[model samples]
Target: MRYHACRIAVSLSLALPLAGCATGVKSQLEVRPWHSINEFRDQRFADVADPWEGFNLGMYRFNYYLDKYLLIPVVNGYEFVTPTFVQHRVSGIFNNLGEVRNLTNSLLQLKGGESATTLGRFLTNTIIGLGGMFDPATRFGLDRHDQDFGKTLGYWGAGSGPYLVLPFFGPSSVRDTGGLAVDTGITYGIYTALDPFADTGHSFAISAGVASLEAVDMRHQQSFRYYESGYPFEYYMVRFLYHEKREIETGKAPTAN
Candidate 1:
């Protein structure tokens, strides 16, 4: 039981981040073409490295149903039960906690300034923002910088390779998948370190609670809905945008508007 609980907790913690990073994506691509939503998804996109288009589109369809039936419903319930102010505080805490990750990746990229900024934001929020239950750092002119192992890989010239739609994780690339594993492992290590425990079941529960809070808060922050964008080439558009966004993120390209 102890071992199982430990495994479950770590897995959940890792899986929960999928929600936060997967959604709330804005299209960085000027969408073109008008493929049927039910168009044959067998062949991969010609330009990108998505060799598994059939599998990816199937997963995309699955994620749409999952979001509509399960994820959105749960987020709706969370919004109904929690006050807006409380929700805001929860989001702040999650963002502040993410500064730790940003800091680590920034250092790996040799971005001394970004690393310093992340540390400053973390300190300000934790101290003045009441353990990041508020975001006083932003008001103090220290906004958070998004960083990850994926961006770290890109910094060192790692190509994205191919697109993939991971089950329950939505869109990612081959390089980004590797980044996710390293990032998740580090995050799990931190959670265990901060919340040391004897009872593995209890530890799992604690991890679940934190992960759940982050997931719900992330969902509430998103304005996008699955399949709501009335674009016929939505799948291809998202694929394009994701890759474009990655390039912009790694400073290899400029932001699209």
Candidate 2:
């Protein structure tokens, strides 16, 4: 659970800078391609009633409270102990998870026995070799990578269905939502060997803690840019960059505006 929290914190740190850059670069780049994608999604978005959107917004508000109170403090406590190591380990865990996701998606997309073999090796190393404490794929020259079902669908020439802000989950494309389900299943299988109740509580605590830490890290990084943009823009900009970063992880070029 601590490991998971660390991963989330690290992801947010990396995400903040990338997101900041995306925002700055937004005006300089032509985003027509992505806009087209967005427009297509907007049609689907409209099919859902505004009340549902409002409900999602309300849930987001609740998440903010969780972020501020429980999650943030736990991350701060971890930071006070060993800032650098904690940060690195957190980032490494996050990257490692991404690599696993990528490997899975890549196999699903590419469909090769060799890919499955490599994925098995990765799972073995991350689970047993690392004491489940770290992911060594990057160090082993496997190259940290990730792919989601959405990217797989895109590779197969399916359009991104829609843009949706899921409550608590954040920004996601229609395809990615399905990808998340598969990923969660994989995660569940991996974690199921442990005691169920204890593992569940620990995982939840760690996730909350990591998110809080990430919010703190983002607050620090965004402080300098706060004067340049309002909170809403900053928020959306962060979401856009995180989503795009995931796309990049799946081996796609940054989406054009």
Choose the strongest candidate by lDDT: 1
TM-scores for candidates 1 onward, in order? 0.79, 0.51
53-126: candidate 1 lDDT, tens digit per residue = 89999999998998889889999999999989998888888888888889999999999988888899999999
Give the alpha carbon lDDT tens digit for every residue of 1-257 in model 2.
01123434565565457547776877999654343223444432133222344554555566566556765555556567757855666554555555566677778788575466557556855776463246554456544344566777767766555555564455566667776787877866765565345646587777667556555544332222221333323434444444444445445534459
Model 1: residue 172 alpha-carbon error in angstroms: 0.8
Reference-based lDDT, each prediction: 0.77, 0.54
As for candidate 2, its clashing pairs are: 31-257, 32-257, 102-146, 102-147
- Which parts of model 1 are misplaced by more than 4 Å? 1-46, 196-201, 254-257
lDDT assessment of candidate 1? 0.77
Steric clashes per prediction: 0, 4
The parts of candidate 2 lying over 4 Å away from their true place are 1-60, 82-99, 111-129, 132-140, 193-232, 235-257
